[model samples]
Target: MTNPLKTQVLIKIDTITYKGHSVIRINIPPQKEISFVGEKAFIREDSSTVEAKGPKLLAVSQLFQK
Candidate 1:
């Protein structure tokens, strides 16, 4: 399953039996900083994540340019 944080993080999960008891083990790798979405960029404003538009979009592009 993917991480709930929406980083598209990959996870490894397994089930094991120990002493007649079942246990679940989850392994989560590190996550990297998220650049804007591939198709469209987004910015957070006032506790909200909104699509970058107009000036905001340009600013985002400039800030994140490789």
Candidate 2:
């Protein structure tokens, strides 16, 4: 029998890290450029509003680089 895969998700905002089964990682670039990860990515005018908008899902090396 084969074991199931264990998924790990992490969300880092400033110096705080939120751990869960699903996460959204947002990277804010200098100037007006904004980047994000996961589904339902919403880039608001404020950089503090980015978050996971849907149900939990597995993510491996999922990143949004600007």
- Residue pairs with colliding backbones in model 1 are none
Error of 2 at 8 (Å): 25
Model 1 regions lying over 4 Å from their true place:
1-8, 11-38
- On lDDT, the leading prediction is 1
Query: What does each candidate score in C-alpha RMSD?
Result: 9.1, 13.2
Reference-based lDDT, each prediction: 0.62, 0.32
Q: Pick the candidate with the highest TM-score.
A: 1
Q: Which runs of model 2 end up more than 4 angstroms from their true locations?
A: 1-17, 32-66
| lDDT measured at residue 65 in model 1 versus the true structure, 0 to 100 | 52
Instruction: Give one digit per residue, the lDDT tens place, for model 1 in 1-66.
Output: 224534433346678999999998666454333344556666779999798878887776666455
lDDT of 2 by residue, 1-66 (tens): 011111112222334345744544544323322224423444344566444444321121133222
TM-score of each: 0.39, 0.19
**lDDT, model 1, position 52:** 82
